[model samples]
Target: MESGKKGGSMESEKKMLESNSILETIPRDLVLEILVPLASSSLSDICNTKRSCKTLNELGNNSYVLRYVSLEGVEVVQWEPSPELLSFLPRCEESGNPEALYRRGMVEYFCNNKHEDALKFLERATNLGHEEAAYVLGIILLCNKDESKEWGIELLNKVEKRKRSRNIGLSELRNKCKAIVRKIWLNNVVCPEEPLCSTLACKNNKRKRGQGWDLSDEDEQVMFDCKACKWDHERTLFHNMLCGSA
Candidate 1:
């Protein structure tokens, strides 16, 4: 058991180092700037990359990155309405990368309501230490039609256990997940049969309302009707100009 634990730790450390080395070859500050706003799930890849080298150790050591990512994780775990924060999400899916795959799953599961496949990717992610995966797992267990809060809490507790050793707590995480679930569920229950009252309002703003007659349309009609009149007027003006010249 001791050798197994030590071997696992060493392997993880080595993997962290190798990943960090690749990132170290590049400038650190630039990477941080590009990474700061990225969603937590995506950031995990960056962290993993940073862990591969000693020179990149500082990248992993950044408390700001950790805090931001943690807050994001909390929001997702709790199911907060975080449309704005989602700007950090990667525009394209990095499905080939396991970490990216999991992040994509989380975004789909919560924000976009693609729950079926979310479970598959998230399960794979949890095996790889993607904290967000654990959060989702807890939620699924708790909220599944046949499941109970007890099972959900157990999953959450497992996450907390991992966090406690790492000095991260599940309290905030649990709260965030619960909050998100509440918002989504409430939205479902109260959501309109057709659409929200806001949809028409949104559409109204999108469509430029004609103040009276659309000036462009009126101008077109006038142009057609006045074709003969305009031609006659031009002819008379030209004749008068010729007469005056003569």
Candidate 2:
């Protein structure tokens, strides 16, 4: 049995080596298609793949790989990176990577208070099919200027229908966004007054808004029907959350 196990392991190794040899013969562009996903999945894996052979090493460090590099567990996303590290983000942005745009947008918007720049980055990210970027962009729109509310709601509704994003649930995404808001807006974040629902049921019931409720959640949405009030409640709700404990 031990000998059989050793034989199987050797067979697997041989097959892997054969595959590697075959991969080296493929067109560089085709190899890049494989490299891009590897970069997006894990930077470490890309490095390992590059180190495994000379051919991969030559192709791995190009613009193609940097454009789709994953930032999921990268240090920059968790905190402000130093100046030397700053250039990395722009390099990734030059490739139009959605994750890079979203990360850079979050920092610029919340930390640097560069709303316009952040929005541009986020909009690009959303255009690239980033679900989280869409959610964050939608929330920012809803709570900000009046002209963008409709567009904000449209983006959010798209987010609401999706069950999973970046391997996290909808609730997790809400919590993540709220956590960032809480850390940044540590004071009273509420609007001056409730946007007030015009419908009779909303007026009579007056389900108080901004008490840590998710705007698009079914349970919360069921509590109010007026579109105006619902948006208002959600807008204030985000504000309240932003002001709440981190």
Candidate 3:
């Protein structure tokens, strides 16, 4: 029985070797075509296999392939958003990867709303010269009520200046994102009046309007005299004027 088990295991190993040899004989383009069909079909295995070869890796990373997987409703994290995807980002940064840095900043930004943590990654990416990172960092800082708004403005200004100098087209998404951040910041931080004081002032105004009385000493005195006259119509009107509710 042990000998039979050994023979079966050897046979399985031989079959695997033959299969691998057959795959190696196929042309590169044919390999990509085959893998493309299977990319969304078995995403986990595709990722594992893609990591093992440069040509296959490129095919997997192709924007076309990515779009297909995305449209097929493959979960982003499974088919595309794996941490190993960061490997491509560093290459982007090396090649003046503004987009890559922006994505990295976004990942950290959305991971948590921790401005301090996002700032560290964003600042580094910007300093290393990622223009999009600068722009995104600006928006993040702008939304962060606790952060230095002045710095946020400066970063945004820098992005504009850099874009003009580099002749990069205006990124509509970045601009829109920044505008959203500004609107939200205004709503939450800068726009509203001081709550306690505004509320108190509003209540005071409402009281005055409702009661039809000014909160002045003269108004108080008149109210006192009127109440006094109503309570004692028999007493001297002069006494009523002198004391309240006689």
Candidate 4:
């Protein structure tokens, strides 16, 4: 019975050694690379893995990993940013992580409509070579009637050049930018008048009256009336410019 117990212990020791060897063989960078695509929930499981691998634990808490998981994972579900993810944003911002900045800008813009914060983060991300951030910020600037329009056009042009050279990922964003640019050029030809709610009083009047125009009827009238307002096209562009395809 003692011999049997000793044999069992020896086997367990061998198994433990083998597991440690396997863990050690997997490079930390490779582990981090694999973890980048995983969701926060998966990373939680990895952190709970029955091993004392400090690298694995570190990867689970890495700012870049948290940002990627939050942007790709929870953002799709229309949920608030996870606490674990939000906790890393400051670190990422301090580190000047472009992707993290972009994600934070998106959260602020979409969730809170805090345009100033969104623009600040997005501009930093863009300056740091984040193409998506540049594209988004450019579009936002394009929609505004301010000095930023020139900067917006410049940013879009830069992105266009980059896309032509690389042309991978961000296909939807590229298409949207193309459509927006084309629409901007078309504006010169169409000379569409500004919507009635451009002014504060007009907006307040609109609020009291509720959605002042019938876009569908106006759109139908455009076919017959050469002078009909391009309300449908303007409305569509307005929505797309602000909301984005995210």
Q: Which candidate's lDDT is highest?
A: 2
Q: For residues 61-129, write the lDDT of model 2, one tens digit per residue.
A: 677888787766565454567773576667778888888888777777866778889899999999999
Backbone clash numbers for all candidates listed: 17, 0, 1, 0
The estimated TM-scores of all candidates read 0.33, 0.69, 0.34, 0.49
lDDT of each candidate versus the true structure? 0.48, 0.69, 0.47, 0.56
Give one digit per residue, the lDDT tens place, for model 3 in 1-246.
999999998998776667566767887667767776675465566677776555566667665444223122322122346565445445443444334444445444544345466567678768767665666666545544554545866776677566667765334434443433332212211121111122334433344345553322222123222321211111122122222211
What tens digits encode model 4's per-residue C-alpha lDDT throughout 1-246? 999999998998787677667867888678777777663345345446424445455666675565544333223223466676565557657667676687667666655667899799989999989887897787567666667756866786687568757754334564544443332212211122343234444433343245554332322222212111222233334454443433
Question: Worst 10-residue stretch by lDDT in candidate 3?
Answer: 187-196
Q: TM-score of model 3 relative to the true fold?
A: 0.34
Two-way TM-score contest, 1 vs 4, winner: 4
Over 4 Å off in model 3, which ranges?
1-101, 166-246
Residue 206 error, candidate 2, Å: 1.3
Pairwise TM-score winner, candidates 3 and 4: 4
Error of 2 at 121 (Å): 0.8
Model 2, stretches more than 4 Å misplaced?
Answer: 1-24, 52-55, 77-85, 164-170, 178-196, 199-205, 209-223
Model 1 Cα lDDT, one tens digit per residue, 111-158: 566677777777766766767567666545544445344554566667
- Poorest lDDT segment (10 consecutive residues) of candidate 4: 183-192
Runs in model 1 lying further than 4 Å from the true structure: 1-99, 147-154, 172-246
Q: Look at candidate 3 and give me any clashing residue pairs.
A: 228-245
Model 4 bad stretches (over 4 Å): 1-52, 59-71, 76-83, 167-171, 174-246
- What's the true lDDT of residue 73 in model 3? 31
